[model samples]
Target chain A: MKTWTIKLIVGGCFILALVVTVTSFFCNDDFWKVNAAQALTLILTICIAFWATQLKNDVRKKKEHAEQILKKIQAIVNNDGFYYVSAESDAIETQKRMTMTFRSLNNSIDLLKKYGQELGFKVNAEYIEKEFKDYRDFVSEHITDVDYLSRSESTLRKHSENIDNKCDIIIWGLY
Target chain B: MIVINISKDFTDTPGARYKSEGEYSGELFRETILIPKYVEAIASKSQLKVELDGGYGYATSFLEESFGGLAREYDIQEVLRTLVFESNDEPGLINEITEYIKMARRERK
Candidate 1:
């Protein structure tokens, strides 16, 4: 469980203990009061001194992992290689360039995904790298067929625009 | 049984492994074409025969993701029962794919 969740649960338990203690005192139940107080003290001490401390340490580790992931993600954001799409006159060549471009982005995004998986975070932007395969396939099929090349190029261009949008979303979401 | 040619119906970019578009990469091939055809074959009670010919050499990762992931998604028995790969002159391509499927099944266990 999250450290904060554990803390909240422990806090609730302590409040319940206090309410029980007050009720027992008003009822003049000295034996029950003493037992409840001792039990609460022991339980609180164990939870606070051991479990809470361990949970805090776990939280600290996760924080460090997040910081590390953010650092790597930021470093990846500065990589401007995927920012420019080739403007080559050849539709086939241009599409080939885009495939390679997404491959590069995929590698970057995949690395971050690996780290995110390890740290138990969601990295849902991998489609920026992987989902372009369908368009690439369409482009590749029409590479030699100039008659269909226009349609392929147009579709690829549209998909490229969508990919660029996802790229921005991925960059912003690294945190 | 329905046999689909990888190099013909798909792209003939041979010797490709990982992330080439079309039938060249295993993952893309599986996601785009393989699974769709497989599902169709299963629904129709037909065995899907996949021709691995005309494409580039296979990569272990691609094979793993395609067949292995398939095993992970569906049952290994179902995949084995529903699918067949043409030797495509590649002596051990089917074996390699089967190994991956087996590995994935073991992982599930």
Candidate 2:
């Protein structure tokens, strides 16, 4: 339940307890009436306490899940930077690795989008999806282009810029 | 019809390990040789034929990344209509390639 609703319930219960005490003091002071009022107050307090505890546990779980997803997003960024730098070197082996990296990068970005959507980051998910599609189209086009190995460096950089732009929002908004 | 022999023109050994079929290992073959050659043939409106028997063997990855990738970029039926198979040495190779193209289309859908 909302914080306001919780406060309202607890406050209302305290007021009822105070009213019962004042009425008993002013009236015939029936012992049973006082006892009934006390019992009702105690039950409401206990129920409120239980609800608050469950809410705390849920918040803690969400925090942990958010932390885990942030760590994964960081790893993806690190790999993107590594691949971008690796692609720029004038080496055949490195060049070959760049294509493989692009494919792997695609899968990572896709997963990030999925996790974001599940976390209710609808806007962020859309951004990731649009950028991912662009990356896929670029790869499909060049996966057959001449000198693709050497030419892919700039493309990798393009992906780096595109993906990094949204990482901030994911980190900031989800938490 | 215009034909390019995979073993003769592109590479004698064509395939990716089944274990890492997603290698994109043979990407070079597809991008640099196979696609350009195939596109050149298709642009001329000439029926393009791929001679598949000369290669050491075919990998599902290589075939899919090439023909399957092509089907994604071009019209599947048009691509298939313009293409033929010269797999006399291995009659099944043509069917496998066709299957890859069909499957790739389904995957995209």
Cα TM-score of candidate 1: 0.35
Q: Per-residue alpha-carbon lDDT of model 2 for A1-175, expressed as tens digits?
A: 6989999999999999999878877886464554767999989999999999998888667656655654554566457443244334543344344344434444455555566666677677567657655654454343323355345667655655666667666667755
Give candidate 1's root-mean-square deviation (CA, Å).
13.4
Question: Which tens-of-lDDT digit does each residue in B1-38 have in candidate 2?
Answer: 78778788776555342224333345666677767867
lDDT of 1 by residue, A1-175 (tens): 6999999998999999999878877877464545778899988998889987898788667646545544444344344322333343454444444334433433455555565565444444445434444544454343333345543445655656665565455445544
The 10 consecutive residues of candidate 1 chain A with the worst lDDT sum are A77-86
Q: Write the per-residue lDDT of candidate 1 for residues B1-109, one digit (tens) a residue.
A: 8777877876654212345443345567777778888888889999989786664433344556677877888878888888888753454458767877778877885
The best candidate in terms of DockQ = 2
Q: What are the per-candidate TM-scores when only chain A is compared?
A: 0.37, 0.53
Poorest 10 consecutive residues of model 2 chain B by lDDT? B15-24
Q: Which residue segments of model 1 deviate by more than 4 Å?
A: A1-175, B14-24
